[model samples]
Target: MDTQLLLLLLLAMVLMASVAQRFPENSCAQYFQYVQSGIGSFQGELTLGLQNGRNRIDVRFSQLGAHDQSVVGALLPYPDEVTVRASLRAAKFRVSLWADASAVLPKLTRLVYNNNELCRASEYNPQSFFNRFFELHINGPQSPHRVAPTPVIHKFPEGQTDVQIKTVVFDGSERSISHILSDFVNEQTATSAADWAPKSPAITSISSSAVPRQRWPTSSVPTISSIAPAPWKPATPASPFIPNGIRASPPSSVPWPSFVCGQEGTGVPYIQRGMEFPRGRYPWLTAVYHKESFSLAFKCGGSLVSTSLVITAAHCVYKIREDRVLVALGRYDLDNYSEDGAEMRDARRIVMHPEYSSRLQLQPDADIALITLDSPVIFNDIISPICLWETAETETEAEIGSIAGWGTDENGNSMTRYPRVVDAKIATVGECARRWKVQKILDRTLCAGNLDGSGPCLGDSGGGLMIKRNNRWLLRGVVSLGERSTVDHCNNNQYVLYCDLAKHMTWIRQYIS
Candidate 1:
């Protein structure tokens, strides 16, 4: 009898050990840290602690009016085995597995309440608790949700009161960081596809038949071996991107060295109802082309940033034959053969951001690219490079910037002899969300244009939105895609979205440096 009792006790201990292994004691803490780190600087009145060996997060939703069943029911009916309990101001969610919890995040939005999605990420307002929780659980800290998140908390269009999550807790395993990031990517792709239509006016290249035929034999193109590259020098105060780095001082204190880049030519500016760019007003402007049957045809616009590097939209270069890519610098009048200062060079290499995708369900995160020319561009007064934007604060201070391209004219016609530049005001995230009807805008992209139809149009994709500071033109944004309200022309009534250059400093520096 004694031997049997000892054996039974041993068996009981083994069973308890197995259960403990499956549900570790520190699982909740691990999950909390991962979420907290992801939340980054958006930490509001969110607190994390352990309750009965389960991780609990305490969040207060002062904006919800009242923490009642209405709020709880919208978050229901729970994802399978997850358990949740709510009080007046606090809630506790015991998640057996974080993976199962992924499906619950979207239901937190107003869409679950049967309201039309007035804007994407309606729940991601920092003023509300759900926004922090969602960001914490979805996007990682370094990868911000939006560059400048909207501060306005929109009310439901309908009479129904919106429920905002104040405080909540998640208890789960330590192996959640990787899973969470994976979910973020997947969700971003799906949400992007749903928000922005693939048929949007991404490519502005006019068909070859529209333009006069120009013969360019393959043998006449410059090869990498035949061209000698000049020694390119880096500009002053070499350092990584500073968020508001140059905001404290005036532009004079941090003057960009014009010897290398950011120098405008002595071309007279002409402004009418539509702005017309003179021969050398915007010198950095470049025209990217693709080889057709026996002649080169205009494809996209680009900004020459260095001796051999040109920046443009990724969609312009993606999946195209490398040898067929050509760039023409110092070109002003496309139809005028008498125009001087134009030099065409074959593209040596094209580098598109790895994250760039046109998949049905993918985020338009990295719609930028860098092209290396076969030969170093001989910079002239009419063909110098432009400076990459150094500070994010400059954008806000300027408010409005200039965009130039030989896109559709005011009448939505084909390419004209000369390009035009117009002033476009920066738009807010909330405004863009409503205008574009998107759920989320990547931090690496921004929206700007005029409601009167004075923004980028067909043939403008890959062009630069430039801002003048201290008498120098700086590249701020790239023309990505414009609202296609009409069939063949850009919807001048809506705003055009541009890839934010400020957000990709690290990636840009890697190649330029």
Candidate 2:
């Protein structure tokens, strides 16, 4: 062989031995060149990678404990910089070379020729001084690193102390070191070293294949305090009227009515009318009505369509004595009968809305009536008449409507007697139709209620169903039978029907005229 070639071969062999002596038996050594110098120290768990001319490292750390915590990142690697990450807890470390071949070759050549040669010449003996010297040069110091022992003190009753020594290494890994330290502390106590060791507290074993068993301590059994017996009490008697075995009276806060409308008959519509004036325009709108019964009594509410023509529920005038029927105009105050106010007129004749039927078994949507007063009601601030029904050009549910008369609130309790009016928005025909399922809510008569729980109730029967037409209120429906029952109150259930006036508009106009 040539002299120069032999020298090269000998140099390679020596270099291999030097490399073997420096690293651990399975250590991976690779030359890495940083694209840029002066990278700051980073402390976090991370993954390292190289892309383009930049070294990228993703660092992760919990900002808080297991719960209620967040993680934030900072200072991503820029171009031409190498990245390395070390995780002491997980025992992981990574490095990425980010420079070109020209920048990395010099470091690789020096390490291979010098370090490898020394390791091979030393026969891979790490303990040898010659091998150690080369190992230190190539890597760093190999002295057994020492850390101060951490003393743990656990306090028991009567000031008894349990002291333990804990050691943690910082060679980029701490999990295994921590576990070993814990085991040493637990087993090293004087009490645990006895030949007949005292059994530990009961520990419930949890296993998938076997039923868990509770292990009890053999040394001592804990004492438990005895509890006293509870005192006996007598039970109260319950009322028969209330169901569910409850005898409690209804809440006093809500005043229940003495008489519920339609309790004796099919039902009564709860009519609601809008305020005659806007807010602050008529302060009296907020005034509560006092109850007063007219000498001549009728079972229904009526609308003064004409000076003499009064439209109402037919059932109100059915089989009623003429003397008992009185037209109470401006009868807003129901409480005081003697209070000086507009006097009511007696009806000369009663004309039911021609379509109004006493024979038709009352369902929910159809009962209606009309009465002709003996004298015309003089329209005044106190005795204003509502508009008569006109053929509805647009009878959609969205068309705003109102119902007005004396009726009860949701609890079947009457709010007023003579004429208390409340108003509610009309529901869409599609919604009302689907709700009531009665084919009756159509073009002529519309349905109202839903929002604010507005609808006709007891005593509102024969009252006026009015709609807002060009900003004017027009009579659209008559208060008829309601679907009696708390469950159907306020026309809440789509099945409960109210009177539909449009169906009898032609008959109403002909008779009233």
Identify the candidate with maximal lDDT: 1
Top model by TM-score, which number?
A: 1
**Which ten contiguous residues of candidate 2 have the minimum total lDDT?**
128-137
What is the per-residue lDDT of model 1 for residues 1-513, given as tens digits with 9 covering 90 to 100? 999999999888766543332211222231121121131111111112112322212211212222222122111102211222112112222211121121222122221101112122222222332221121121112222112222333332322222211111122212222111111110000111111100101011222222221111122112212122222234433332212111113333332211334545421011112466445556689999999999878878999886678898888888897798999887878885434436787888788888888652233467888888876654433566777887653334226667888777667575756777777777777777788887866666777766775667878889897865443567888888775665666775687777888888777776654
Candidate 2 residue spans exceeding 4 A from truth: 1-298, 359-366, 415-419, 428-430, 437-445, 487-498
Candidate 1, superposed: residue stretches over 4 Å from native: 1-260, 267-273, 359-364, 392-398
Candidate lDDT (C-alpha), each: 0.49, 0.34
